[model samples]
Target: MTTMAATRRMGRQSWRIFSMQARRCSVAHDHTSSSDPKLTNFGYREVPENEKSKLVGNVFTNVARSYDLMNDLMSMGLHRLWKDRLVSKLHPFPGMQHLDVAGGTGDVAFRVLHAIHKAEHRAVGKLGGKSEAKNETRVHVCDINPNMLEVGKQRAHKLGLENVEDLVWMEGDAEALSLEDNSMDGYTIAFGIRNVTHIDRALKEAHRVLRRGGRFLCLELSHVSIPGFQQVYDAYSFAVIPAMGELVSGDRASYQYLVESIRKFPSQEKFAAMIADAGFQEVQYENLVGGVVAIHSGLKL
Candidate 1:
């Protein structure tokens, strides 16, 4: 079937599922409660707002070793393209300091440094100067997963990125960062924010740590807007992905939950509104690869 046809079919199925769920809920509860209904945001897991971090930590711990490989397999290397696009937009300059939250494996930080080096070289070329490149840019990678951070640090060391010394890895929570307010020039989170339970709290934390005029960048899986693509994507995500995980990482359940979480995340417009609500200004988003992923940029005023 065409992509449009697949999308229409999925829409009908979704409506049917919703109707069935509503009927079940109505039958279970004839009377309304004054208290709020228990909610499971994404991944179909029941969790309190306060417990999301721990739950997410468990997920990272389970998949840290296979995380990078799975990313390559699942996105067919398109994630690297997305990251490269994010780096291009970042336009990192020399001496700029960055904080990468939930930046497990340091991919974003490494890319930021690469961008800075490129910018420095470009400036040198303009000056008609012959100067040895110096690594002075700084970035900190903060995550709740120590093992993931360790893997990133080891990779950095292997690359002889001595500036990796400047890349501090801290076991930290995104919702409650320990960094000082208005201290960072840039902030980034890749495929990490959705795992956060209290996304608003994390956004607030990002705003607090960012200086005035600082940029906040997030790259994540997003709801695909194209017709017919959803069915193909859903089939791959639900069936092929878990099988790949089992074959590659020996973990199917974690990948299953990961896919479910992506489906459960808020739509692009809803997420942009949340960013604006968290005190960010001039929020904008760019859809990549037909909206399979998106990069959202916001500025702190």
Candidate 2:
């Protein structure tokens, strides 16, 4: 049991490990999977609907070790900022429970935990705050890929965040979360909802698992709609992105699929409507980086 003083002493400097890992992503180049034809887009190419998850799973398995690095390289480190924005808006309080779906890297969980720590410490005005573990502000990080969950587990330990339980490192799908209905105080899936085969089903699952007043927050790449900026962003995403993936992950095809999937995603307005359809209320979204990405949030009212 680390004291708040000791934990605080460990310092926020540790948070930069994620950044360093990202920076470590090789600028060097290399080149690299997939399923069915029932018909889904595997990066602009249609494939069996059932095949998409398997194909996406393979992409993650191949790059799990370098996933953070690739994220850094691809987003030029902006991903960290976007995640930070998500956590800040969450405003997680002590003893609040959260579920970070498809965020197996512990990225979103860590931020919420950190925010809780900061808040509690501020309230107490000391280093070693009382354990909230009994009613801890817990976050269950769930993902379909074992490799990705393993990486998330490793990151959680590296950050000295193992005080929680196995619920923290769970294996589950977005479309059918294993968690009980109305069990969590918050639900978040950053840059992951679009990958689901039935995003509507996933949205409903999100709504189902969250307690009344719980919020569903998602951060994803959005279609750049501004005329001039859209052209430039499109060129970069279609051309420079996969090329960057080749350099960083030695897997151009996987990255190409990622970029193409973003293009396949619905516009913000339509997506917000889906959330509403899924039974979430007060739905809204905000564009970031000139519409390169957006954060959509709703309440399970």
Candidate 3:
């Protein structure tokens, strides 16, 4: 089938699944005493909520080796542009402290450091100051996947980042961050929020961790708004992506699940509302690459 036709079919299938879910919920409410085990949909799979992390972990573990490659291939290297845009908006100061939650491979953290260094260099050149400058910037990269964190740590070391020891690689859940409250100057997550089963809780955690006026930034795959982009995008995601995964990572099913999860993710407006509900103010989003991805920015006030 053509890309357009395939996308239409998938949209229809998604609608059917939604309808089925509504019917099931209605029936369950009617039979309150029924002992039918409750089921939650995790990317079209009916699984218990508690089981989702393990399943998601398996997907990441399977694709960890080729995850970065897949990102480059799928986005035609535009993912770098999207991330750069996010970093630009952040405009990290030399003294800023950031918590990068779900920062699986420290891509965002590394970019943040680069932005800070560039900003500092520009400031010094503009001012022509001879005073000693202090680099107070620090980033804590937190993720649930230790394997990903280990790889990221090695990459950081290879880059010869002076404060590599300052970059804490913590294994923690977004829903319940282990960090102390009101301790972070900024919080960021890239392409990670959708994998979270409890997005609201995660947002709450973000709010709790961020200091007043601190920024919360998220870069995620969002629903496309263009006339024909969704169809083409879906076709590529569903068809070519898995094949690329097989070729690069020797894992096809993991990539397939990633595509489905992106489809299951909430719309940009819906997600912005969720962020607002979690006490973030001035919530805004910028679409990248014809709305295939979005960078959402909000502040804790």
lDDT of 2 by residue, 83-143 (tens): 9999888888777789999998888888887887777777665546565543566778899
lDDT of 2: 0.75
Q: Give per-residue CA lDDT, model 1, range 205-294, as digits (tens).
A: 999999999999999887775655655667667777789898999988888888777766666777887799889999999987667788
- Give one digit per residue, the lDDT tens place, for model 3 in 69-171: 8787767677888888988888787767899988878899999877777777887888898324434667889999988887788788788863565467789
Reference-based lDDT, each prediction = 0.76, 0.75, 0.77
Write down the TM-score for model 1.
0.85
Candidates in descending TM-score order: 3, 1, 2
**In order, how many clashes per candidate?**
2, 10, 0
Q: Which is superior by TM-score, 2 or 3?
A: 3
